[model samples]
Target: MIIFVYDNSFEGLLTAIYEAYYTDIKPRAIVSDEYYEPNLIDNRIYIESDITKSNKVYEAIKKKISQDALRHVYHVFLSELKEAPTVIYKYLLIAFRMGYQVDFLLTNQHVLNMHKISKKVSREKHRMLGLTRFQLIKEDFYYAPIEPDYHIIGLLAPHFANRMADQHWMIHDVKRGAAAVYDKKEWFLTEVDMKLQASVGAEEELYQELWKTYFKSISISERRNPKLQKNFMPTRYWKFLTEKKQS
Candidate 1:
């Protein structure tokens, strides 16, 4: 078996795909060097990320396939699944051959797997949009921390950049040690320390209390359903929710 290994960057993965397409031997797997495990039986090739080659693959996907297909490929990459590289490679091979019609190939396992994983990442992004809770750390600065299952901090940046155009804010993905920081004009993603320290002021503390109180006051005790609540607001996300915090 032959495997293509690349640096974990999206461009690197694209470069690996480009190399795979040109090579006489089709690779059985494409993986990041970070997660690669050596095997004596398997032939491994390390792919250097070339922006020119990566961009060629990127433009080809956009022009040959549909723009939506390009989006699916990116979303699947953000899933951070170990098999994501191989899945993307297979999906793109079918996409290049089938053109836009690849989306209609629901029965195809590779196509279906790509759609499922992409949808999962998209769903989490949607959930984070509503569920993210921000605390005012200082004057005009807000910070929100999330621990999503997928690498979605970058996906969430544009939404908040538009919504909070006038305020400096940050959305930190604690689980991944990465953050999307907005400086009132634009946003950028960067690596952050796992142990981020931000002090909540007295006003923010009071606001948290009021918000938690409002949450409880609006709920009808007699009709309250923990199961239903958990369905909407998963227990996994309660750690960052102001209303869900223990008062």
Candidate 2:
């Protein structure tokens, strides 16, 4: 069996796909170098990320397939599933042959799996938009921390950049040690230390207390439903919520 390994980046994945199309020997699997485990029986090839080749594959998908298919491909990449690279390659193979009709192939396992994974990533992006709560840090800047199941910090940046256009803010993905920072003009993604410290002001603390109090006061004790609450706001995300955190 032949396997292609690449840097754990979307561009690198695209470059690998581009090479698979032109190479005489096709790769049985495409995997990120970070997750790949070598086997003596399999021939492993390391693929270098090339921007020009990546762009060609990206444009080909948009042109031959559909814009929605391109979006699905990107979302699947952000899911970080171990099998995503190989699944994308197989899905694209059918997409290129069938064009837009590939989307209707619900019977095909690859196509179905691609849609399922893409929808999961999209759902998390939507939920995070509402669940994210920013706290005033050091009197001026706002910071919000999240540990989403999918890699979605980049997806959330544009919304916050437009909504908080006048303020400097950051959305940190604590799980991934990366953040989307906005400086009142543009937002950019960068790596941050996992042990990052940002002290909240006294006023911010008071505001959090007041918000918690308000949340408790507005609730009806008789109508309280723990299961329903957990359904709406998963327990994994409650650690960052001011109201959910223990006083």
Candidate 3:
């Protein structure tokens, strides 16, 4: 068996795929070097992230396949599932042979897998769009922390940037140790090693209390349904919600 190791970045995965097509022997697995533990029997190939190679693969997909399929590739990557890179490689292999029609080939497991993972990523992105709540922190920064199952912080950035274009905001994915920061103009993602100092403003505290009171006042005790509420707003996200906080 052969294993292809990459830098864990999307570009690195693309570079690995580029090299895989030209190799004499096909790789059995494509994995990030960070998670890859060397095996005694398997042949390992380390791939460096290359912009040119990654761009070539991207352009090829956009040209040979449909733009919609290219979007599927991105969404599947954002799923961050363990098998995502290998599944993408497999999907592309069939795509290169079958052209744009490969997307409709539900009989093909790889294509189906791509669609499944893409759906998961899209669902999380949509959920975060509605469920995310920001608090006013020190230095006039609007900080929102999320713990999505998928790598969706980047996906959430554009929506908030457009909605709150005049403000400086940061969406921190605490689980992933990454943050998407917007500075009134552009938004970018960065890896954060240390915990952020999340000191809420006094006005923010007042708003939180008021919001919680409003939430309690509007709910009819006899009509309350915890199960229904949990279905829409999962219990896992309650920690960050102002209305859910203890008075």
Candidate 1 Cα deviation (angstroms), residue 209: 24
How much is the lDDT of residue 152 in candidate 1?
A: 84
What's the TM-score of every candidate structure? Answer: 0.86, 0.86, 0.84
Q: Candidate 1, which segments miss by more than 4 Å at Cα?
A: 197-228
List runs of model 3 lying over 4 Å from the truth. 196-228
Q: Model 2, 35-66: lDDT tens per residue? A: 99988988999999999999999999999999
Clashing pairs in 1: none
For candidate 3, the TM-score is 0.84
Predictions ranked by lDDT, top down? 1, 2, 3
RMSD in Å for all candidates? 10.8, 10.7, 10.9
Q: Is candidate 1 or candidate 3 better by TM-score?
A: 1
* Residue 211 miss distance in model 3 (angstroms): 24
What's each prediction's clash count?
0, 0, 0
**Candidate 2 versus the native: TM-score?**
0.86
Candidate 3 lDDT by residue in tens digits, 117-228: 9988898788879889998755556778788888888788889999999987767787987767666756766654545444555555644543443233224344221110
Please state the error at residue 10 of candidate 3 in Å: 0.7
At residue 117, what lDDT does model 1 achieve? 100
